[model samples]
Target: MDENSIAGAAREFGGKVQGAAGTVAGNDETRAEGKRDEVGGATETRVGQASDTVRDVAGEAGDLADRAIDTGRDVLPEAGAAPRRGGDTLTQYAKEFPLAFAAMAGALGYLLAVAIRRRR
Candidate 1:
């Protein structure tokens, strides 16, 4: 797919041919060199393949992140309003029943303290 992959494949094929030629001519040194080229070519091809895979995964992650941002933009306003309305309701309740709200808040704080102490 990539230049390295193509070049490595070509190199490997050349090595195979060279190795065969050496065998026919009975040159051990030439055969050894050809075998070395073959291994180097195969390593280069694997490096190219790994590079391609990393590029693809990075592209996919970028696309996924873009989609997530778009979705968040579409949903945020409605999500934001819920908490505002809940806060308004709590304010109304506290105004109408100060003592009850205080008692409830104290009880919640006590429970949180107990939970923290148990963790420690």
Candidate 2:
């Protein structure tokens, strides 16, 4: 446990002891003080737990990010090569069938325009 957690537990234990002593001695003020200490200790313990949880989550996020970066590095070259090959094939086809490609391109643009107009 962290310092805060340990301190909180100690405070809580002391409060309980004080409260019991006050009860035996018939001292209302000591009893109230003991109760207050118990609450403070509980708050401290919660704060410590929250801090530990945050640290754990942050470490996990960092690990996930590192893994993502490594995966992207490993896959990028092969993934990138496919797009270049596809572009080259399209270029060759366009060169061999210029008129047909132009017609198809114009039709595609017109269809896209119509689709956009309908959406609006």
Candidate 3:
């Protein structure tokens, strides 16, 4: 958001400069191109805002999933220590259900990425 707003402001400033200079120098093309750039920058700012929203939503969802996983991990261990002994059992289950685990992991990773991107 900050970046987009900064860029947009920069573009706006540049456009004002270009338009002034073009008028003084009598160059229609420079004026037109400057207008185009100003528009592009505005569009980029909007896009950046949209991206930030998506990233925020994704990060929130990921945080929720992480909490759920933490709960599950907590409950499962307390459920029964027999057969499912120690941390190895969970690891083994993950290995056995590779597809399922992979899917979950993928989701988790995606959320993490979104959160990280938003932070940046």
Off by over 4 Å in 1: 78-120
Candidate 2 lDDT for residue 56: 92
* Residue pairs with clashing backbones, model 1: none
Better of 1 and 3 by TM-score: 1
Per-residue alpha-carbon lDDT of candidate 3 for residues 35-67, written as tens digits (9 for 90 to 100): 777787777777777878888999999999999
lDDT string for model 2 (4-114, tens) is 888997898888888888888999999888888988898888888888888899999999999998898797857767889999998999999999999999999999999
Which segments of candidate 3 are over 4 A away from where they belong? 2-5, 20-27, 73-120
How many clashing pairs per prediction, in order?
0, 0, 0
Per-model root-mean-square deviation over C-alphas: 4.9, 5.3, 15.0
Query: Against the correct fold, how does model 2 do in TM-score?
Result: 0.62
Give all TM-scores, in the order shown.
Answer: 0.62, 0.62, 0.48
In candidate 2, which residue ranges exceed 4 Å CA deviation? 78-120
Q: Name the 10 consecutive residues with the lowest summed lDDT in model 2.
A: 72-81
Give lDDT per model, in order: 0.88, 0.88, 0.82
Better of 2 and 3 by lDDT: 2
The residue-level lDDT of candidate 3 at 115 comes to: 100
